[model samples]
Target: MRLAEIPLCVWRTRGQTFLFRGQNIRYWTAGQGEPLLLIHGFPTASWDWHYLWQPLAQRYCLIACDMLGFGDSAKPVKHHYSIVEQADLQQALLAHLQVRQPVHVLAHDYGDSVAQELLARHHEARAAIASCVFLNGGLFPERHRPVLIQKLLLSPLGWLVGRSFTRDDLVKHITQIYGPQTRPSESVLDDCWSLIDANHGTRIIHKLVGYLPERIAQRGRWVGAMQHGDVSLRFINGAFDPVSGHHMLERYLELIPNPDTVSLHGIGHYPHTEAPGQVLRHYLAFRQQLQPFKKIACS
Candidate 1:
């Protein structure tokens, strides 16, 4: 059976969906304690967290969701995909779930941008974010490396590229980003292809790629939050990732005040997926360092 069809040993069988902005948003909740929200990257959904889910759930009330246009969620072809909108959907999801206490955010790839926006809101006292752990991501737009395909899809000729995008193309591009030592298995590729194919999501790559430009425009606000020192921010990186690995870390050290980073020497872009155990250990340790905040009950 394909990994796409078979749940990981750690995956929970049950899932729930909520109506958000007239669309169905799929999510899963498990465990109990302080709420920890897992935000996944572009072209993937909450499934990216499966390896860490069952274990982390034992310690926190884990909530992972498929943001609009990804995974099993509604994929609207014409909708404008913005990091701020994604962040708003996340806030709305927490409100709908009635989780009033501040949440610990663990975000990767595109989700990291969403997390940055959330952290910015927290800085402005507009949201409840306790702590954040960012996996390999393009937090610094200046350090971002958009793969040729991403650049093509975001270009004026994006419609042609989107139309030509195929499962083989997806598998090839994704596999290239992993470390030489931790190449993704066929099953992993299958799962990704299945998710992207669901709801004809591949067709919306042009719309989804819009976040790249938005990231550039809002860099001052989002990156400012990371540098502001309002809430604790730690980055756990996979050093081998050609995209946002060591280069981005260098920028983080030069920019953010007192930045914290754990380098996984041989790992790549998807540390949580490529090396979950190590990522989890460093993540748990990072969480421990943040000064705990008293939980606020949502009336």
Candidate 2:
């Protein structure tokens, strides 16, 4: 069934904020069951989950936040942004909420990297993540194919590029990542640009793009966590995504033992947005196969 869409304004209204390390982080939560955490990709926020929010919330308590520099959250121009810090933010949020049960993580793009770090913690018995499902992302640095804009953002001229970047430029770059047949609507693109433009977020694009290099430098830790972690794992990919599509899936199957995967033939980077129904169906099927967790006790 096609899920009803959650409008951006309503999404904003439903959200609440809490301070994290002197920055305001916006978050949204609903439903009640096993805890499920949703982490979005770079340049986007928790609103990325709006399409699947209600449908997934039907079966799991949902938690999603605009990480320190993205969405409606604070964007500190001088602060350093790293996947490790983002993972810590997620842990802090879970702790702040007093979530005692192991969480089921659904992460996309940049979020996939953050999930990898969290999974690394789980592998070391430092965190309680029950499972992780990755959408399109740079899971393996070698397999990731960043677009031209991303390359530019990483160059020495990156700060200047971020300063001069325009909404049209963002829309153009985002369009390149989706399947031709499933490209986002103008309105959808507008909402995405709105979130990025919030709190002068565009000014910090260069810093946030650091996750690309960070992924490469810490490849062993993150990738090893995926290969060795005992938690349930699944990869749901959109085949046409230029950045991390079929090729990345090939690498995943090569490295991850007993891999569980689902490939959306004509979809692209934003599977949850481009084809929410299929994503929902596949994700639900995967969750159904997992053993049930004990009810989470309230604080």
Candidate 3:
């Protein structure tokens, strides 16, 4: 979709706002079936799911939201953004929607960490995440290769980097993460920049980037969830993603037993955006295989 049409798409979704911890969070819901929660990556919003929204909604009740400091959500300047807090917001959204059914999670980048935390809660009989499908992300902090800009954003000079980073820089850095063959168009890149720049989001980016260190510190708890959690898990990776592509997949295979994975050759960090058809296909296939097990669990 072109940048010109992004607003139309957002309008069609008819996103609404919910009060979360005294902040208004932007969210969208559609269709009516088993609940499917979508968590987007860093520096982006729920709109990241725009590519697969309708298709996925056709099969499941879709729930997506912009966490604090992202997308159309409240961006409190001093609020500390952490994966655990984001997990709390996800749970709050489910409860607000009165979603009693076990939910399937589709997450990417920063969202992956939030999903991991949710999975950990599920292990503790706290959340009802039935399954999870991870896109490219720093699942293992050790294997995560942050780009130069990310490193800068996480450094002591991060505040300066956030203030000085421009749209061109965003396009440049984002382009580097995409596969060589499947780079995003200027319009898409523009939309990304606009989303990031909206409501002074760039200002709090340094604070949000805190997730990197938090990921490392809490790696044991989150990875333990994936390693031992009862919920079904799948990793659908874009093989060409520089940040967490093939190498990340290798780590997943090494650590996760009986792993279910799909590697899209030449695809990049944003698989759903870069190749929505392939992502939808694999995701649906994974869900289809879970039907029998889902029924048993629900019973």
Model 2 TM-score relative to the real fold: 0.96
Query: Model 1 clash tally?
Result: 0
Q: Model 2 segments beyond 4 Å from truth? A: 291-299
36-71, model 2: which lDDT tens digit per residue? 999999888999899899988889999999998999
Clashing pairs in 3: none
Clash counts per candidate, in order, are: 0, 0, 0
Residue 203 in candidate 2 has what lDDT? 89
Identify the runs in model 3 with alpha carbons over 4 angstroms from their true place. Answer: 1-13, 291-299
lDDT of 1 by residue, 1-299 (tens): 01122363334256688998999998899899999999999878888888887788889999989999998889988788888999999998999999999999999999999999999999899998989999999999999887888988989989788878888998878887898888888888887877877788877877898989899999999988998887887888888898898899888888887777777888889988778878878778778767422221110
Model 3 quality (TM-score): 0.93
- Model 3 poorest 10 in a row by lDDT: 290-299
Q: Arrange candidates by TM-score, highest first: which order?
A: 2, 3, 1
Per-candidate TM equals: 0.93, 0.96, 0.93
Q: What RMSD value applies to candidate 3?
A: 4.5
140: Cα error in model 1, Å: 0.1
* Whole-model lDDT values for every prediction: 0.85, 0.90, 0.86
Error of 1 at 20 (Å): 1.0
